[model samples]
Target: MRVDDFCDYDNSFPDEFYACLPRECPDCGAPMEMSEALTQLHCSNPKCPSKVVQRMVAMAADLGVKDLGEARATKLVSEFGLDNPLLLFSYEPDKDGVPEGMSFDVANGIVSQLNAKRRMTLAEYVKLAHLPFIQTSSQALFGGYDTLDEAYAALEEGGLGYVCRKLDISADSDVSVRAARVYETLKMFKSDLYQCIDFVEIIKMHSAEMVHLTAVCSDEVGFPFKTKADFYATVNNLYQNLHVEFLGALTRNCDYLVWAGADGSPARLTNKVKKARAYNEKYEEHKASGTLKEGEHEIKIVSAKQFLYILEQLVK
Candidate 1:
């Protein structure tokens, strides 16, 4: 069976069963190569539209550029000739863009989204590179190391040593392999220096088993708005303030449900806070009943600002 098939019955594969087969990409009919280690293979042709689209998909997804789906990405290249992610965000005076059939406003809107995405945190950009084994969840994996001066430090501290130490698993284990891949990918990205992009977007993904965000800029102290006009913004800011994405909080699997609000008031609780409280309750129940595993996140709600202050003290 192929690597993708992945041991229908066994996790380990015998050496004799492995062999490269002559293959052609069904999408572009180009010759494809597969490493014994990799589960999936793609067309060898870099210009292949299908191959490009998936890369685009990875970039857009990591950058959080909404609505640039595979269908749209494919159309952007095959139909409109906008083949590059940078180009997707950019527009020329002559090209009436966006996959032929889409309206002018829609095309402009897509470009607008792309422009907005240009400004992002370094973690998000690294995630966008779509490097092998660097899943969104692994963003938190970097936090385990304490001495790395730069992200590239993961290649040193967070690589094998990190795996063996924090994970308490072999450095060569599959899980460690994933961490090692992140280190390798970061090195590869660093080779192409980026000067204009803001490195301040570089936010630390804190090491936690469980974390729940809570904050709502209500009528009280909420900035730039009156009467909770931006409740969602409050919840989002909590994530951003932590230098963690909304999804990153989940990935770190924070054990604490840090509640940030004006007096933990119900009226101030956004949907995120409410949901977190509910989830925390479930976690408590499961833990009490002994259904939760050792590594499973323990849930507790700490004061919001205080919660962050702790991170400030620890991370800084």
Candidate 2:
């Protein structure tokens, strides 16, 4: 009983339906992809009015710009014609175009607040990438990734391309496109952001266990492990890029002191080996004497392959 089945069907419905269909974005013209039902349409275009506000909210949080909510961002765009988030730093307010029932000075204060927070540390800025490559939901970005400078090198060396290809997200994909916009927005304020970043700071884990890797058993025939560097690299791999900082001298705060080969052929003891032996001797004495301090972890000593075996159980 539908009009499409009739012989003299009217084509007006098709034209009206096409005109009113919410299939594409109003601002950027990208197709609207809904989660479940087609009863509503949300813009995936990063530059679109709605999506821009969402990014602004996240960017504001990253920059520590308080009191600037999504509603305020939307109002600034829809009412005052201020669309780009970076424009807030230099937004000039006048007698008109302010939100309804809000004074121009109050609006100006909001802009001032955002401008005040334009500067953030390089660590804070890099964390805003929210890329698929790094785990975003934890402190792993700073603790697990290499030094900030080295991490930047990895990013420049096709890390981003790797993520895009792995996810099958072309450079033009919506989320990737939005990530590009976020990058540009930060770039616009790069000078200020860089001013606040401490170039010499190095991020590390909470308290890493240190060990010694001697070349004593490195070249021994029939040995499972190869060289000292190979041993160091294996332990470093377990930590996922955190340097082991092999104890070459006395360290006051060492958590572990693994002997390269406790049962190997006799070898000369350097200052580092002497320190490890002395520390463990004292540790064993204190433990037997029942004088071990509360909340203190005893230093451990194991062979090269034994250390690797212990780490193998923990790496995953």
Candidate 3:
């Protein structure tokens, strides 16, 4: 007989099976709440030991620290009485005793790995924080800010109402409720969980897609363009197929400096222009001294006409 034929026609299972399952979380003894769909049971306690261990393992992986699997995380938590995953960053080999099964060297290696990842992008920090209902899509809420301080200041000043306004979400919408939860969770985490590590740097995230080259246009008017917006539209339209990205500022990664102003003219010597030229000079000096690393290239300074010509040839 086929297995399907042997099974009951109805999907219902025996009531005994449901009774066999525990109604409470095994580790934390918290009541387990059944989902609305009745497909899964969720422990209501956020501080449940099992959940904490899982979070510890996940946070370690997300932070790029290797070898911090579930078993190791459990051992660390039990040994150190760790209440929060972020506390792992504070573990000191000199001050703390090694876990029963782990050697001092292994523990030290884990600390070293964690320390090496002190510099993280803002997006990475947000993901690691694991704020409630906040995912990658929420990153757009932080657009236009180049530093965490600026973003945090705005959030503090405006609160969840600010986030809803920025996201164009109605206050009574389901998404607004989620945004409120995320805001409250972020505030809670910032005070305790986020203070666990002394960060070396928190780089601002860029929302643009990756491109082979990035160019910055001078705001000063010059040939073939009357305004900055006109320059942007013309060049960007012509070079859309050239894998080149444009930005308003001359960051370190910029590959081209497009300026239509006359050479050495006051209008041409803006801070961006001067910075790009200085960078090129430093890059050349490094190249001549045999200290330049591979893949390092100087920013090419070009006028609008020259840039358009270069892009035209490149597309061909």
Candidate 4:
């Protein structure tokens, strides 16, 4: 039987199997610990050479810097004595010597690629930082804040409990543990990390004024307006005080979905309508279960006439 199958069936490994396994990491001589799920053993030392090289390669890829594979990353780490992956951003081709056997052109090219990606969105920076269990879509963590310092302040002030409450994550969930770990990691290294990058800006998709009251004007026929531009012009001219922002596409943040079709007797269900309805149905379920988070607004489908009337009432 296979070793995996034997382990699954027996629920314990043979004494010989345990004896054969290394108690310490072979590369760094650090203690080896089982992963949280007990799936595999890993080096306890975060500063292990192997780990540093792997992190550099991963960070390069995450930051959209090309050609910095394992081989190149290993050489850079060894040649420059890089302690952290973030140090890769501070590489200066003119000041720092290129790794032996690597041409100046190649080194310059890599530096140029890194320079090109200096400015990044907060979500992208989080992914590049390789925070534990955090994905590229870190909007849940950094959405409301405009700057990293603001988000970090919130994290520090609220602690893990605040993060759990903000994200609607259960305190006992694995995600909460990961969130805490991420918070600790950020606290320890956020300054160094932020200093390495040129710019880290949070791009808010919807403004606070329009976040809960935004609408999308679909391009379906039968509306009184000739084009979307005409509709926008009329709305801006008449409802200037309402501050109603119109989107070109349906998004989860959108509050109102206005189409050209008549209410109750619709001509066709366009993709925008379908998406809006799907979002509404999902939010309705969340609302029923009382699991809806703040800003989780439902989309209200309305005809062009109803949209104008709603705006008029709001303006009044």
Which candidate's TM-score is highest? 4
The window of 10 residues in a row where model 3 has the poorest summed lDDT is 1-10
Regions more than 4 Å wrong, model 4: 1-12, 172-175, 198-316
Each prediction's Cα RMSD?
Answer: 10.6, 18.6, 17.1, 11.8
The most accurate candidate by lDDT is 4
Worst 10 residues of 4 by lDDT: 203-212
Ranked candidates, highest lDDT first:
4, 3, 1, 2
TM-score per prediction, in order, is 0.48, 0.37, 0.55, 0.58
Q: For residues 57-165, what per-residue lDDT tens digits would candidate 3 score against the true structure?
A: 8777655566789999899988877767767767887798788999888899888866666554454456565544655434555554546667678889999888778
Per-residue lDDT of model 4, residues 235-312, tens digit only = 544532444456668899987887766476455778998898899899999999999988898898887778888877
Error of 2 at 316 (Å): 42
Task: State model 4's lDDT.
Answer: 0.68
Kindly give the stretch of ten consecutive residues in candidate 1 with the minimal lDDT sum. 224-233
- Report backbone clashes per prediction: 6, 0, 0, 0
lDDT of 1: 0.49
* Model 2 quality (TM-score): 0.37
How well does candidate 1 match the true structure, expressed as C-alpha RMSD? 10.6
lDDT of 2 by residue, 156-238 (tens): 45454534543345776677853444334433434433442342233243336422222222222123544453344334445
